[model samples]
Target chain A: MNCFKALLLLLLCTSLPAVEPVKLTDDGRMKFTPVFVDGDTRLTFVDFENPKVFRLKSMDWKTREVKVVHEAAPAPEFDPAYSIDGNYFSFLRTTGGLQVSLVIRNRKSNEEVVIAPEPGFSGYRTPAIAPDSSQMLFSFANNFGQDIFRIDMKGEGRTALTGTKGINIWPSYSPDGKKIVFTSTRDGNYELYEMKPDGSEIKRLTDSPYQDIRGQYSPDGKQIAFVSHRDGNAEIYLCNADGTSVRRVTNHEERDDYPTWHPDGNHLVYVAERDGSHDLYLLPLKD
Target chain B: MLNIGSFKTKTCSGIGRRSFLQMSGAIPFGLGMSGLGMVTADEVDHVVAKAKSIVFVFLWGAPSHLDTCDPKPNSNSDYRGPFGVIPTRTPGVHFTELLPKLAQRSDKYTLIRSHIQSAPGHPDGGTVALSGFEENPKPVKPNFGSIIARHRGFRGKLPPFFSIANGVVMDGGRRIEAYGGGEMGAVYDPFMVGASETGKVNIPALALMDDVNPLRITDRRQLLQQLDSVPRTLEKSKFRDWNRTYQQAYGLITDPTARQAFDLTQESVKTRQRYGQSVFGQSALLARRLVEAEVPYIQLNYSRHVEAITPGYEFGWDTHLYNFSLLQDQHCPIFDRAFSAFLDDIYARGLIDDTLIVCMGEFGRTPKINVRAARDHWPQCYFSMWAGAGLQTGRVIGESDKNGEHPITRPITPLMVGTTIAELAGVDSQARAEMRVLDGGRVINELL
Candidate 1:
């Protein structure tokens, strides 16, 4: 489960040009949650200047062009996600500093409604839209515990997919919509887990002592990439769908997190810390 | 034997054992009368100390020191956080912009930037910060308030020591170790006056049942005393233990002073508005009233529970998630408004010279922000603001490194803080010996 492919690459040759991680954005602001790259090589992320003014910006890898798809909604908005068809967008908005509600907007109608938590729900974070854009899955924590849940776009058909006794977060749907991958602390420390859409027959993917969060599947759904703290600091790592052939992706001293797979599945983009500023970087997985 | 042996003995200030005996016109040096034994004025100078009372605002969850008293503006974005630095009334001293009010009133307090409590875990750190010792070795060290209560005893109708909250400070499942009597015994435990955000005061320890009124409480007390009169076969029983506790509760319920002190309606509309309507704000107002009531020691807990992640939930200084946002939106603004008004009210009311005010959290957040865009717990360095109690005002003591990670000057530990508080509150050497806590605790000479 713990294979150091990068160490092997280093041992094989010392003269090869360094696999430098590419910087995508130079802005020193926070790279908000839910930074993802779609199948079209277009990357989307919330550029957080502050709660009052944040923008969901996207950059095309092929053309090197950037644009803001939407401005953050009123109040503090975080973890923005765009629907596959680009008809709807979803994000988490906190009222006060505590009660969190999922906000979904219909682009065509210019209408928005807030999905508040049930009576005992206390916290919500990292909302992700389904591939079909019909349902949204997110993680919510209460006084009792934390788990992941899925709800329809109309605020109906809410289901607790993973109701384990520990924190489960960052649930992402596979491209085909048949499987879901997420990070869970149910086994003491954060590790990746893969399960069916309904959350049955779960299988542990990466078993590392340190935190392994934001486990995302590739566009082809053959591999999973996540951020691991096994190296004493957060760095990106990739593993096969069956939890084998683990390999390190991004190697940097400062913290690197939220890795998103490119359309070609051979490249990965993630937020990396350089000199105290957080910026997105594109890594070429050509080794 | 007048059966007054259980009462608090040992005269303090100009009151207590000697005063009670003198006031009662009892025979001098009567036999079989025993309690705190005997003490000389020289041994009990702490009783006549400068500070008549202390209001310890324990910010249970650690706030980021970089964002509070010790701001590093020259440091880059990572260490400086999101807020900018503002000049304080003290020349060359600046605090994060969130604390503009505290900044303006900097002339009234001593801002110590090199405070450190080594335990990073919430419960351990909170306990040490509040009590000056670790929670291990069975019974933990008594809190500063408990020690003060033990030596000073009750002054009037009000309890000697009081905590403002339903319960003591807790983080998740663990409570702070020094929240109660600890090694000094349960008699020193604070009589808590709980308050919600709406400014309602409820005393859970003394709260009578819905059907139990003042008359009913009296009836029950009489019945219990009657039952106690029926002599038991067991010769060594401590059944009479309820006498002092019951008397205190009855006095609180019936005394107009106690009720009036807790009543917020008595405050002027402008005064209440100045403190703001948040739970912490109202609690600060309550602390001022308690001071007027002459409570020797008061622990004004900012939050009932620590580690509150969401806004509408219980509030604490622990900002593990979204540290900057929460501070900007809720924690900082409330503290800035309430604390500033509290300082002004204390000074204007002429309580400043006698009443000691100390505000601080258990620890502090890390120097560098984490990947989650929030700061984690860093116990190496933090800050505390001290005012009144004859302390040197408009002064900044000690300094942290450039990044505010570690103290560059002499580090002030919780032990020093407890020692200073106890010494100023008038807990003399004799009382500290009796308490048996803070054995090696030394006062911060610079503070005095």
Candidate 2:
């Protein structure tokens, strides 16, 4: 009976046409914090099979193969950004369990560098590389609170881009490389804000009672996707680049968070909790 | 069991008015006649009790002994970590600079630096620390509070014991077995009260308060009739044990004094601010009120979350990474402030001699810092701060090695703690033997 069931499942998977909001993991473990690249064919995410040993993993659905991007590292790595050519990527690494730093690694050369090392600060998070791959933007933390900082690719000559008193995190570089978008809590609640790459002419993009965090610009630079807890629980939300025309994207009673836009721009990948397990799902935006 | 508190004619003749008055006159002494007219041998010797109540503050996730109570500044950097050490009020003792409040007030308590747990995992260590027994598949041993409740029997309107936490301490699939009555059955279970993230007190069993008001029982006769209509089978089965629980619940609702024992609103704003505005601090304040009500045992769990470092959700001392940052930024500050306030409040209320305050965790963190800059679980050597109960104050009992790994003197076990608490609470060895609990438990004589 088990053999027959397995054969039936195989047949169904082969016969059915691909559908939207397709689950990409079946391990019955939490798989979240996903980033999509390579024309949305390849995906990278944090897999929590063992809650203690979180792994940076990648899966190619077309080839039906999975690989570990970082092996044997226990601390949480956050906000992985792939360069335009996908050859190099930059992410935030937390060591000593809570001290956060920026790590730029070359997957081919297998060499890694720790840039923008946290001296007296707690760490940094939400790293974004410029379109030209010449600089990186990240939120740095100190006793006063968190502010966004920019550094050159060589891990030298860091500059403070935002010196707000409250938290300013989840910075994303716009496609044009001239602008940066991020979330801030200066007004006492987390809201989206946009500023130039040099930190001039800061404008508030969103204003809501609920917390809006982890905002990312679309590949086409026309819309922004972010996570908000306004509707009782965390759900993915989309708005115009200027923060108007707001709409809910995915409405699961469970949490839907960490939405990462795909290269194609029509679809996005996010972490969704369903039936007690967290897995990655691909959802196409509705017109 | 229904006549557990009643007298039989086979013992003695009915007392006359003259004899009753004479017996009542001796109540100032150890005449053994309780307010309910029921007497027991334990009550006859109640004057010997060193402590009328105990506030067992369980630091759910183990804190680093080296970082808190047993700092090893002379050791290498791997053992010392980042913070510098400061001298306490005691001549020879010192604590980490992170615990400035405790350092300044170290004379108010006794620090046992050689306390050891049986196992290292959260559940195992918690079981041994609270119940004085290793984890096994069979019936779990009752915690000291459960045993006290059993020994003391019903005291008054309030339950004899209480566990103040949002919920039970949980680690994955397992939990702290000592949180309840354990093998002695649920009848002796400590009444569980939860303090929310917003610092509101709630009792899980009393959540179905739809129309029922403790202050206003609209139909007393109807309620009594329904209570009497329980089936005979249920009356004879384990369900019958709930009768006492229901009576206690009813009394807690209608009796203003009982309700006041759990209310934080009655405290002045300055008093509440002294304890800080955090949930753990508020829970400590509630524990103090329970002490005021003369509740025998109260366990105030710091945070239910044991492993992960998810701030604003749960707080435990399990620092797998960024141990220093977390201790500096969050854990130590809250504990230092709230605990200092608790000690001051108790002392000012003159409860210091009549109450026993024990502050410790399941175990201690590793002495040497791991590569993660966090300490792992180390059951070999830990520290427990004992105050009140007339224990010798401003002293350090036992010593850890230079590296803070093992004990250099006699090691203290959880069994000794259980025995000491039980003994101080007036549960004699004869009573423990009769109850078949703590069969060979030995009291820590040095603590006295």
lDDT of each: 0.70, 0.71
lDDT of 2 by residue, A157-267 (tens): 788888744567778888888788888766645678999999988899987755677788898898999987666456888888998876777776556778888787877
- Give the alpha carbon lDDT tens digit for every residue of B90-120 in model 2: 8767887668778888889988877775666
Residue lDDT tens for model 1, B250-270: 676566566677777677766
Residue pairs with clashing backbones, model 1: A97-B310, A97-B311, A98-B310, A98-B311, B46-B426
| Model 1 regions more than 4 Å off | A1-287, B1-48, B213-245, B305-315
Sorted into a CAPRI-style docking class, model 1 comes out as incorrect
The 10 consecutive residues of candidate 1 chain A with the worst lDDT sum are: A9-18
Model 2 misplacement above 4 A:
A1-287, B1-48, B209-244, B305-308, B311-315
Quote model 2's TM-score.
Answer: 0.58
Lowest-lDDT window of 10 residues in candidate 1 chain B? Answer: B3-12
lDDT tens readout by residue for model 1, A148-259: 8888887678789887445677898888888889877566546789888787878788887456778888888888888776664567888877778777766665557778
Q: What is the TM-score of chain B in candidate 2?
A: 0.83
